[model samples]
Target: MKIVELSMVLKIIPKVLQIFLNFCLVLLSLILSFLLIKELTMFLKIFMTDGSSDYKMFIANILIFFLYFEFITMIVKYFKEEYHFPLRYFIYIGITAMIRLIIVEHDHPIDTLIYSLVILILIIGYFIMNITPLERPNRQK
Candidate 1:
């Protein structure tokens, strides 16, 4: 084989290994995240005998579910070669985190409103940055 092909083969060996590891991580993250949601449900069922706090428990469970979904989405993106470190995912996580904060701090109306708006602005900026197509490829020049 040409040296170039041999070198490419050598380079690809590590990448294939990484793909296996990436798949394991994705599976693990999905399993663990769902397990957390399940565990939270079990906890709610056991502790909610006192129905006075039912609304609080419901909100808490929903927040847990949302956070788990965000984490699984991030892990799936890690398998991408071009976006192994996805800043957009981080922004998404941040926005979700802010929403969680708002839900938890609803009593503080001003702070809750501020954080909600911040999350809105951040999501808008994320779309603006990511949705625009890349500059033309060299062949188009």
Candidate 2:
């Protein structure tokens, strides 16, 4: 039998690059989130009066929250070995996003219903994937 030397193991550069990219991307997203929140808060000040449609500001807050939450999830998942996506969180984001899209788009009701159906299918897919059972524990075949 031939022996495999530990020193002969080749380094994987692409994974290293991917790690670096995920880190930088997260930082960029966080910075952008902060800047957007600052700008939106300032912009909403004009609508402080009664009878103003604060819906824009409310939707903005929901979007900003989801953006930052996704950034935080990415940061946490960067070091995890297993698949790192939080399925429920993504589904929740998708639902909120579709709602926001409907609110902002004013599209035909039929189109909006179709879009919502797509989002529902996506959430169901995620749930199915998350609930799938593992075949084995602690041993590789």
Candidate 3:
């Protein structure tokens, strides 16, 4: 009886921890989203005030916003998929981040080439993940 009780307690512990972690994740996501919005507003205000014609800065800011958007989506997906993170979202984030890096700092040819290669690898991984089939457990007869 003691062993059974201990086992039950152990199982309950994990569930409790998972719930707590999920709550924290939600709170963090909300905070990050608010921060992103504030940054975006600041960017827009700067652009409006300066009346500058620098398309690069505008594009970079847009890409950064997409990164934040993807992160939030990833968090939402974690809850929707029972705490499992889908690989595609991570790949998407990686690709976006690399592109942003290239756009913001592509002065060196070798560095640009390496970043491009990284983006290529991430694209290949995304393709493979999409093509792979998920295995379902077989029902016992």
Against the hidden reference, what TM-scores do the models get?
A: 0.59, 0.63, 0.88
> Residue by residue across 1-106, what tens digits does model 3's lDDT show?
9999999999999999999999999998998799789879968776887668877888888898899899999999999999999888999999999999999998
Please identify model 3 stretches exceeding 4 Å from their true place.
136-141
* Candidate order, TM-score descending: 3, 2, 1
What shift in Å separates residue 45 of candidate 2 from its native position after superposition? 2.3
For model 2, residues 52-100, the per-residue Cα lDDT tens digits are: 6777666666675665666556546644735366556666667767766
Rate residue 129 of model 1 by lDDT: 78
lDDT of each: 0.78, 0.67, 0.91
Candidate 1 lDDT, 33-54, residue by residue in tens: 8777796776668576665566
Q: Pick the candidate with the highest TM-score.
A: 3
Which candidate, 1 or 3, has the higher lDDT?
3
**lDDT, residue 4, candidate 3:** 100
Off by over 4 Å in 1: 1-31, 34-40, 43-53, 80-83, 135-141
Segments of candidate 2 deviating more than 4 angstroms: 1-12, 39-47, 54-57, 80-83, 134-141
Residue 113 in model 1: shift from native, Å? 3.1
